[model samples]
Target: MRKYMVTAILVVFAVVTIGTYYVQASQETPPNYKLTTVQGDASLVEGIAVYGNYMIKDSTFGIKRAYITTNGTDYPDEKSAISQSLNRRPMKTQLDQWIEEHRQFMRGKTNTSGFYENEEMLAYVNATVDTKRSNDSSAKRNAKLSISVLNKQKNNTLEITSDINVDHDISDMYVQNVQLIDQQLVAMVFMNHSASGFVSEPQIIRVNLTTKEIKNEPLALPGVKSVAADGDTQYAWLANQNLEHTDQWILRISRNNHRKAYQVDVKTGQISPLTFQGHEMLLNNIMNAYGQKIYFLQKAVSSKENIGFAVISYDLVSKEYETTLKNTHIDLSENITYAFKQDHLYIMGYKNFKGNRLYVFNLTSGNLEYEGKVISTEAANQAEDEANMDLNFIDLGQF
Candidate 1:
């Protein structure tokens, strides 16, 4: 009887302990465990959206014209859009003027038979000229976005809605992005009223899909540089700098060199500071989140000396930065553009001015998955190695 009682008591205690552990585990759910599956050309995904069984692609940069495409039908067709915000002209500086002058001089000097004697030097000249042109062109902001909804189940009928127009007091204002947040789409616009000012404050336009009501309001924080939104959590990284600085280069360097990140709750409008262990200059841009981890790109302070960058992971629950990927060979500062899709981070850059190469890294294991050439050496020289400038991707839980 004594032996049996002892054995029964031990079994009961074991069951109770196991039960308590499971209850605790259930209460503290791990980061998003949803299996992420990615297909098609990951490089081409600039902005993405999912509706029922369809994936909407919003490819904006590098290309001559930005367009949206739907994958619902067998034959995908590009659709044009009308931007919700006003176009802002680029503010030119002394450096820009110098670049323009130098480019013109190069064109005149290499005008012999439409080519120069030294091919390599000619490529460098052409690349510099292209960079100047891109900088000059990006200043004049054009169309924002025009949305046409489609129902795959309903014979792919495109429902064209009346476009929303932004009220602009100045021409130097443009829409930064139109993103889907919490099943509701909103447009973020940066308005530059001061022709002499370096930085412009941001404005938010909330759109109601059902009612088509547009509410335009100034963002709570003026220093908010960029925002990364997910289904559960929405956060914006703010860079506070002296906007009164006359020179834009100085303003940008200060903004990049000194900045702080914050977590903004969309529901309660509560803001909390995000603390991490690293120099402010290291954190360049915040990429989309995977599960409960927020991933971001960090450029080293002195790129000329190190020529390296890092990938930082910040855990929401722990409120800490988990990992930093910095290798001697990984030259992230040289990258023109980057994208994080599914489980991989893609970086596009030129290899010794040879061609554009795509470097893929697996986020889960924090490993370099693959590296391959995205463009030919000749093409890279011709386009000035800015072919991958259009890289973008929609967040995992955005839709």
Candidate 2:
């Protein structure tokens, strides 16, 4: 009887311990969503914009107009669009041929080294002669300063033209960065050529669609390269870090009044330096959405080849550093790229060179999971070619 009682007690204790362990593990694990790459191309993805199921990616080849697919079928064929305010002129047959030749030259034999490696050559070529080409001239003339939205379900495209129309003859200014805030398209324009022989400062401009007017808001920093805003706090964060070095600063600007700008500090600042492991960290990007939260990526200050990336989130209400997304084992060098939409944080990463993968993490659930890779490089290349065929279909004269 004594032996049986002891055995029963041991079994009960074991069961209790196992149950406790499982409960703790479940509580600790965050809920994560799955994101499939669906498609990608090797033509140097310049920018990515996400809206509902529609995703627009701009590349050297052209713009890839695609929609998110959950169960394999594309949403629908969405029409490509350009700015409505843009007055497109009829291109002479000679000019059309010239544009085609230039496009082929850019896509084909031109050295990729010109883009990434040699800045001087790229600057000189793109500035002086390339600007005279038909496509380049059209881009300059149109200056499509607003965001273009494609409705996949309806197979329609909507171009939101910039409210501010300035006839200042600003020829070389290119749209460097764009973000959607409360249905308004905010754009950053910078001079294409670096006159300072180092880096150029970008001008922050905001356009109100309802008012149809443009506001020229120069950034507080003279050499500011990028700007990210937290809508909840009505604060805009600008980074002036050179990619080659870690010397950088984040300026907090009041959205209500662009003139009111200050550096982030311990008391009033939303950012915390403690979240980053490295002293030499440079801010790369910032993403903020309503009720979703704001997150930013910082590259290590050091020049070490193996240094990892850090993701920092800030609480808008408390103005405090909330969490640090750090996993040293995960190599995020070229492996990670993120996009924020609604309540979803889409983190696309690859574990190895053989395959491209994507992971979707829910900020609210704290859940992280691998979604799987949808499109391979070879497949992406084919899709890009198909999209380029429609380039001739659009009547530029209607612009």
Highest lDDT: which candidate?
1
Clashing pairs in 1: 46-392, 46-393, 82-145, 82-146, 83-144, 83-145, 88-173, 90-139
Give the winner by TM-score.
1
List where candidate 1 sits over 4 angstroms from the true fold.
Answer: 1-148, 155-169, 172-183, 194-198, 222-260, 266-270, 273-281, 284-291, 299-309, 330-337, 348-357, 373-399
Give the per-residue lDDT of model 2 (tens digit) for 269-293: 2333322334213233453423323
Backbone clashes in model 1: 8
Weakest ten-residue segment in model 1 by summed lDDT = 242-251
Model 2 spans > 4 angstroms off: 1-171, 175-188, 193-199, 204-215, 222-293, 298-310, 328-335, 348-356, 373-399
Q: Write the per-residue lDDT of candidate 1 for residues 1-399, one digit (tens) a residue.
A: 999999999999999888875565445311111111233444343333211111111322112222212221111112223322322112232233333644543333221111111111221111010111123422532323233333323423222233333322223444433434443444445554322223345555555656755565665553553221221122222221111111110011123245545554333334565545564433456555555566766665345754656677766677677554654555545434555655567665423322334556777677776554322123324353233223232222211
Model 1 quality (TM-score):
0.42
Residue pairs clashing in model 2 are: 30-366, 30-367, 31-367, 32-367, 280-301
Every model: Cα RMSD to truth: 29.4, 24.4
